[model samples]
Target: MGIISEFKEFAVKGNVVDLAVGVIIGGAFGTIVKSLVSDIIMPPIGYLAGGIDFSDLFYDPTGGDYASLDAAREAGAPAIAYGLFINNLISFLIVAWAVFLLVKGMNSLTKKAESEAPADAPVEPPKEILLLEEIRDVLKAKA
Candidate 1:
């Protein structure tokens, strides 16, 4: 087969289409999770943690004095942004948890579907058994 045909075959496969759709949905889900963490979840947590903005929590290794993270960056200070890492970590955990629950629900549904399906019909008796029964019936009738 030609290269173009081979490529077309691969691209048109059901699995490939499913994977592409999954990737698109996953990207959208990631954006939603990021927004949820940054906007809704972090605000309350930050408030409980003494009204601290975790995104601004950083350490300047050069010991430079700065009022904020943007100021530190503007001053060309080398800083470790641990707060951003924490936010990202929380987002990742939440996404992972959501995926886990989805998988659990899908698995339960699959199990239920399998259990509800009808079983295969039972096998009939062999031809030899039928023949023997017929012969026995004839001998009994003759007797």
Candidate 2:
């Protein structure tokens, strides 16, 4: 087959299509989680922590006084930005939790669906019963 046809076939395959869709959705999910952490969740946490900004939480190795992590970096100081790391860790936890709940719910639904579907196919009678019925039918036909 031509390369064009081969490429077309590969693109249209079910697994490839599913993977593309998953990547798109995952990117959107990541964006939503980022926003949820930065905009919604972090604000309250920061407020409760005495108005501490996570991105500003850094340690200057040279013990230089800077207004924020950005200021330290601007002044050419190698600061350990543990606060940003904390924010990212929180986001990762939230994402992992959300995925876990989603998978759990899907598994429950799948199990429920499987359980409700009965596999009780009709059983055939024994060969001896069939032979007896055939003989009875023949006797009746003769009568």
Candidate 3:
């Protein structure tokens, strides 16, 4: 097959399509989690921690008079970006908790669905027995 045909076949595969959709949704979810951490969760946390901004929680080794972490970094001063780390940690916890709840709910729903479905429906007779009965009837008629 031609290169275009091979590419088309690969792109049209169900697994590849599903993977692409998953990647898109995951990216969107990450953005939402990041926003929740940076905007909604962090402000209250910062206020509780004596007005300490998590993103600006850093210590400069040189004790330079830079205004912000970016300024310090731009001045080539050594500083620990602990605030960013804390923010990321919070985001991880939130995402993990969300995933746990989602999986748990899905599992419960699956179990409930299975339990509600009828399980003891009567089985039909085998086709072979029906065919044998027909054959016996035909033979008796001939006799």
Candidate 4:
């Protein structure tokens, strides 16, 4: 086959399509998780931590005092943004937990499906067996 045909065949494959769908969904999921972390979860956390804004929290390696992260960046100063790291860490934990729950549920379903045996149905005997039984009946009648 020509390369173009081969490429077309590969592109239209089920696995490739599934992978593309997964990537798209994963990107959307990442966006949702980011929003959940930044908007929903972080607000409460920051509030509980005495009204600290975690995103603006940073450490300057040069020991330069900065009012905010943006200010530090504006001055072209290097900083270790630990608060952002913390937020990301929390986000990662949340995603991991979600995936774990999903996998656990799927595994539980799989196990249940595998453990449940199919109902036993009566199977017909072979034709030879039936013929033998018929012959036996005929012999008994003759006797």
Q: lDDT: which candidate is best?
A: 1
Write the residue-wise lDDT of candidate 3 on 6-28 in tens digits.
Answer: 99999999999999997898789
- How big is the RMSD of model 4? 6.2
Question: Candidate 3: misplaced stretches above 4 Å?
Answer: 2-10, 62-65, 122-143
Could you tell me how far off, in angstroms, the CA of residue 123 lies in candidate 3 after the best superposition?
5.6
Tens-digit per-residue lDDT, 40-141, candidate 4: 999998999999988888999999988999999999899889999998998899888988998999999999997795658578899999999999999999
Write down the lDDT of every candidate, Cα atoms only.
0.94, 0.92, 0.91, 0.91
Model 2 segments beyond 4 Å from truth?
A: 1-6, 122-143
Q: Which lDDT value does model 2 have at 107? A: 100
Per-candidate TM-scores read 0.81, 0.76, 0.73, 0.76
Kindly list the per-residue Cα lDDT of model 1 for residues 1-143, writing each as its tens digit.
69999999999999999999999999999999999999999989999999989888999999998888889999889978889999999999999999999999999999999988876867779999999999999999999
| Residue 56, model 3: Cα distance from true site in angstroms | 0.6
Winner by TM-score between candidate 3 and candidate 1: 1
Model 3 is weakest, by summed lDDT over 10 consecutive residues, at 57-66
lDDT of 3: 0.91
- RMSD (Cα, Å) for all candidates, in order, is 5.6, 6.1, 4.1, 6.2
How many collisions per candidate? 0, 0, 0, 0
Question: Where's the lowest-lDDT run of ten residues in candidate 4?
Answer: 114-123
Compute the lDDT for candidate 4. Answer: 0.91
